[model samples]
Target chain A: MYHDNYEEDDLAAEVELVTSAQYPQDADVDDGFDSEGVVSSQKQPIAVEIPDTIKNFITYFHRNVLENNIYELHTLYEVTFNKLTDRFYAKQPWPEAELISPLVDDDQVFLTLYRELYYRHIYARLSPSIQDRFHSYENYCDLFNYILNSDFPVNLELPNQWLWDIIDEFIYQFQSFCNCRNRIKNRSEEEIALLRDNPQIWSCYSVLNVLYSLIQKSRINEQLLVNKNGGDMLEAAGEYGSRPLYKMLGYFSIIGLLRVHCLLGDYTLALKMMDNIELNKKALFSRVIPCHVTTYYYVGFSYLMMRRYADAIRAFSTVLTFIQRTKQYHTRSYQFDQIAKKCDQMYALLAMCIALCPTRLDENIHNHLREKYGDQLAKMQKGEDSISVYEDLFQYACPKFISPNGPNFDDPASLSQVNEPYQHHAKIFLSDIHNQTMIPTLRSFLKLYTTMSIDKLAAFLEMDADELRTQLLMFKQRSRQQKWITGNLLEGDIVSTSDLDFCIKQDMIHIAESKVGRRYGDWFLRNITRFQDVIATLEHKN
Target chain B: MAQLAMNRPEVIQSLIDGVDRYNPDNISILEEYLATQCQNEEYDLMANLAALKLYQFNPHLTNDRVIINILAKALTAVPAPDFNLCLYLLTEPMIIDESIKQLTALHQLLEQSRYAKFWETYKSDSAYEQLVSEVRGFSRAIRSIVARVVSMTHQQIASSLLESYLDLSGDDFAAFVKEQNWELKGAIVQIPVNKDNEAKTVVIRENIKFEQLTKVIGYSNEM
Candidate 1:
């Protein structure tokens, strides 16, 4: 929807012919971007100026906001605003909310929405300064306070996509703040003091409080339950939940909690957040492609960490296939690049899970995985020398883990130990891999014979029989995991995860492998469709 | 509701499954609940991890003894990734402490199913005893895990090896086998056939459900 016919090369140009046609206040004023004589007191490399077109756009945006014209806002949010961003502020921050407040008549709601995009742009393109972080946090508090605690049924409406983005970006910034807070190095004394003093800014407790409060205020859990099993919708929605604004926010907040808990390494709690919302083509999260990809990304990641490899494989495969099937529909989304990036990361994770668990995958996903991670997957399955391969895939694909607490500013010595959380997670996961390092070798040996004495197999592997026995036991235990059938993500039955199974009696080991049966359904369906096509063609010819 | 904390205590279920998990004041409640789990030999990884999670955000509330107890209980749920899940929540310095290192050594031995070595190191130093002082019957808890893994992997184990793994002997081993409904034949202990130990050939066919076929059925109406 963005026309990239702009001739302006400056990151903060005032306007271009492209956006000016709609607003017509195009004052192509570029006064060399002087850093001095800036309006706000916050020192910036580029000065903040309300370009005439954006100023005009904001006034029109204010009218649309007043009318609650979500249809207009969707085009404005998904296309016009982004096209303007690419034209004017591609490499620079948007005009500050305060700087443009006058153009919108100081309308708090519009200014709040503008600031959301303003700070989101800073986070996306430029590095957000500490003040930017704090002020953006305050702006969020203002926005949420207006919607939540306002005595009236707030006369505001938002498209579902924007609502999801609000929650998504809110958690993103919170996670960003957490990771930033963990790094206390290379910061000025003033920045450190600001961070140390205002401990509530982007605090974990406060962030979770906002998400949970959204869920509770909207009574979203009850609403979801009523939707699932028939019930009184009005009673379930209560007052706030009846409003789309509150309902969507609350629903997305559940997803926000999933991402947050996964970031905190609470994998079980991550999945626990999605108890009511089933992962399907029709879930509200699927309406936003990024949200859909994100939900599966975290769910798959949590399952991988929780040692449920089969479930992880299923989660990753389902979403990867969905993305492939629906590619044409969302390739133009504003977050398409972000979605594609997550799509690639999920492929990497799927490769790792497939190598570890040996699950059959859809042909399309399998080909993509082989294309993306063939050599690494080969090295991973080679065993014992593939530690670095696993770690590289993990680092590339895993969520950015947070340490939850900020640096102990009281002790400067501890500040240098910032890599502790990442190292901690890597160590735990690598050790888990180390336990199964002997599986490939043992599996080959097991497949060679249905019944073999443990002592004889140990001789071939040049190890003690007792040690071989231990490896076999490890295989038996590791290859069985809890899989979701029809319930909350956490509740699942313990099913055999491996294609191979074995039993040990006295000194003898017996091995068996489960193979997938030949499928006639797909072949019949394909033939039936072809036959129908032939019949239709013949009848049309007559 | 996902608050299906199933078997967990109501107070703990509410606390751990809600925003209260972030509350520093509620940690003592989880801590006390952890102590009860230890006393009853009733391990709950979710609740224990919740306690560690609270300690993670609130450094002041961290109790090394409670952490050790939690890890010790996690040692009972070995091969489930519970111990490492708890370890993930602990800071680097806390994980590398002399006490945690000693426990980790036992944990490694146990994970490798080196039951004999685990029993040896677990009993090696007085510090090991002092380290697990908070856990009421840490030895019994770990023994049950060993007993479980052994039965799952073996239909019959040499009595000497089983005794070494369990760290029980003669009459104690016999009594243990009897309690488990297992029998002691001359040189081997015969465990009852269970699902995991049976290892029958299973053909995992595709489970195509009626709902998945509804679309195909719709095409039949067109026909």
Candidate 2:
């Protein structure tokens, strides 16, 4: 049901009309209108006031019927448009098509555009069968084309501020509808390329405005897989010196963009975005709109994927602290319950990160872990040979930890799909723990002596001297990378002779540096500081 | 005297009137008659009302799947049924009918503690207005579920947040807390753990522990 009037012939006739002498081009007329439509500078700028009827309709719309009531708004637009047209036609016989100035003012046109965009959104959500009969998208396209072809002044602002807001929302919704339809239809690359590459169909400002709107609305999830078409548009905006535009979109948009990257499995890009946000935190978080806890969670998750344990821990800890602080007020609410569940997952992940990092759990956390997972912690501490404990923890925690409030928590298939990455991480943690079993044994052995013979040490460890040496060498390498280790195990000669002496002497064994202990202290202190920072931020805001 | 021929509409009307009067015996007689007249066109609404009356008579009957089964049947009936009652029945935990998957999605949304999403979906879909009107206590049931989950952790919570969460006003929330016998301190609602509830909580924990243990054992056997 799309109207078939927007033919190439019609476009050509419209172009001819604009260039014809009926509309004289003034010196002020700019060629920049070529991309939009033909513009004719007004000889006398008309002070057209929005009629009281349309103004009242707008006020009623803003107060009672907007985003939440689409069908009502649609009906309102139809009735008002007919009434206005009927009144105009009754007052004066319809003028010749070329001589008729715009039937409605800019405010009315903007409302029409808003209603069309809402219809497009509703149509997008409809099933394909019903959508086949719905020409919302085509109708919207035709309206835009009409606006471009007609001599509607493109520069005049709509009368109301709410109208501007609706325009922003409309642009975002239009692009989102197009993007969603493209995916559902699985449009060919050529078709998508035509949509994106064509400056007429897709402009840099439109795409940037949509992106900015999505961020401001805190809808990063919708941004996933949708930004591919806007890639070049974003580049063009940057090239066109749209720094102020980007700034107005603000840091929350950057966080949203970062989350989009994370959802798209581009951890590196997400981390880079996080760095950008961090560099401008004072400007970003200082705004009235505070950063979402989910942003921090995604950032932490991205860092976790990159195996940046310390950063991951910090990010997850921040999320947990934020959740805890907010939960106090609405502890009996479902939102708080969901947040608390998320905090549990974050806590689990933080514990896993600590396990993988060059850190030990502090007494408080260790006790908490023991209480939470008494048997599993005991098994890990005892250096068990079986993988059952780790596997159990992974099995028990991964599904919930991955998506604690996922809709399909009870669906095995969806749960598995959501938990895949978490399971992979769990496996990596398990393997890492398996390899580090020797470190704990070595720590225990070192507690007994400042020095020991290499043969005896190997015997105590139930391994060959070469094997023990290799393990010690791994520890030395790790220590070199992380300064938590105090000293390295240096091999030396016990006697001043030509013969090489291989003995685990005091210097050879080197008092096993309490790296784990030091790391634990550092981690605990950092966590406390982060917790305080979150509390301080929340308290300061209040 | 001729025996009264109880038709489907009369049975439904009687059930409704009985529920209004708290006359369970009259409801029981109507429900028994409804069972024989199940093939009647108006049986779905009648059956749903009967189930709802039973549930209201004893709130603990909310867990009975049989009540849900009757409601689910009513949902699939030919004539237009009271969808609100069907929706309320579907919200009961452990409803397992494939025909009511959309209702199940709503249930799962609530089950997963996505209260905001559930309410948004509920409000956005005008089709649910009938259900919203018919099932008067459904929203309260949802609020109770949320309250139960939240009470598992916190002993006291801000009443203002509770008001917003439950879609109640300040006075209404205070009245609700008082009605529930919960202690109110200024704007804070102190949700006390009932001794009976604590025992039920223990049972739930035990059940979860048993399930996890079985799962672990099953995994070990596979290995």
The C-alpha TM-scores of every prediction are 0.91, 0.34
Model 1 pairs whose backbones collide: none
* Candidate 2, superposed: residue stretches over 4 Å from native: A1-61, A64-249, A263-265, A279-292, A330-334, A358-378, A385-434, A479-508, A512-542, B1-223
What TM-score would chain A of each candidate receive against the reference chain A? 0.90, 0.43
Backbone-clash count (model 2): 1
What docking grade applies to model 2?
Answer: incorrect
DockQ (C-alpha) of model 2? 0.01
**Candidate 1 CAPRI grade:** medium
- What lDDT does the true structure give each of the candidates? 0.81, 0.41
Candidate with best lDDT: 1
Chain B TM-scores across candidates: 0.89, 0.42
lDDT of 1 by residue, A196-261 (tens): 999989988888888998999999999999999999999999988999999999999999999998
Pairs with steric clashes in candidate 2: B84-B131
